[model samples]
Target: MPGIDECLLEVMRLPGARGAAVVDWTSGLALGTIGESPNGDHEATAAETAEVARMAAEQPVFAGDAAVAGPGTRTPGAVPPHPPGLPGLAVEDVIITTAPGYHILRFVETSFDSSVFLHLWLDRAEGNLALARMRLGDIAERLVLA
Candidate 1:
């Protein structure tokens, strides 16, 4: 597995990648950051993005509504689709596209409370949404939270 810094570097190598960070959605903190931030401030961007991640992860309605995990889609929160017994939440990732860029938030599943996610900012014209999402998923898997 790669460390947080290395993982973020790999993310920046992606097409259209403008900035990347390992953000703790629970506390709205950026554990690591690289490249240019959306607002010229990595910390603020991390906090702002964490709001979206927290909202998506903590809400059960999004999970239940996730018929398909397409762009701008939010995964289910800490519950099983069936049996519905576990208090744990779930998420693959979340993508928010804009006129200027695309935001990809890939959730990192930890052995404990999985509150961290990888945030990637990419240029709208140069970025490939599908590719970025898939690559982020790969990075998320290799990311070690400890």
Candidate 2:
């Protein structure tokens, strides 16, 4: 398994990859980063992305299995009047695409309840979304936070 720096470097190998970062979504903080940031400020980018990830993860609508979040997950419980019962969820990744680029946020599976993910930004012209998504999945599983 590779650590943050190495995993990020591997992510950059994907075609059209412009920047990458290992972010702790719980705190909107970057553990490690490389290449250019989506907004030129890695800190701001990390914080912005965290909100997206958090919104998705925190919503019970996305829950495949509550157990999937596990014990250490910082996810505060979600509440909505409409749905009487919600199933637990297993979120593989979150992808946001635009005319110029794509941002993929693949959640890292860790031993502890983790709120971390790998953020990869790629240019739409040269990037392959499917391949990038697949590769990011592999990289997420192999990422070793310690």
What does candidate 1's lDDT look like per residue over 25-75, in tens digits?
Answer: 989999999999989999999999999999988776565335444444544
Error of 2 at 122 (Å): 0.9
- Which tens-of-lDDT digit does each residue in 1-146 have in candidate 2? 79998999999999999999999999999999999997899999999999999888777666653454454553455532222222222567899999899999998877777889899999999999999999998998889987
lDDT of 1 at 71: 43
How well does each candidate superpose onto the true structure, as a TM-score?
0.84, 0.83
Clashes of each: 3, 7
Instruction: Tell how far residue 55 is off in model 2, in angstroms.
Output: 0.5
Score residue 92 of candidate 1 by CA lDDT. 69
| Model 2 misplacement above 4 A | 65-89
Error of 1 at 121 (Å): 0.2
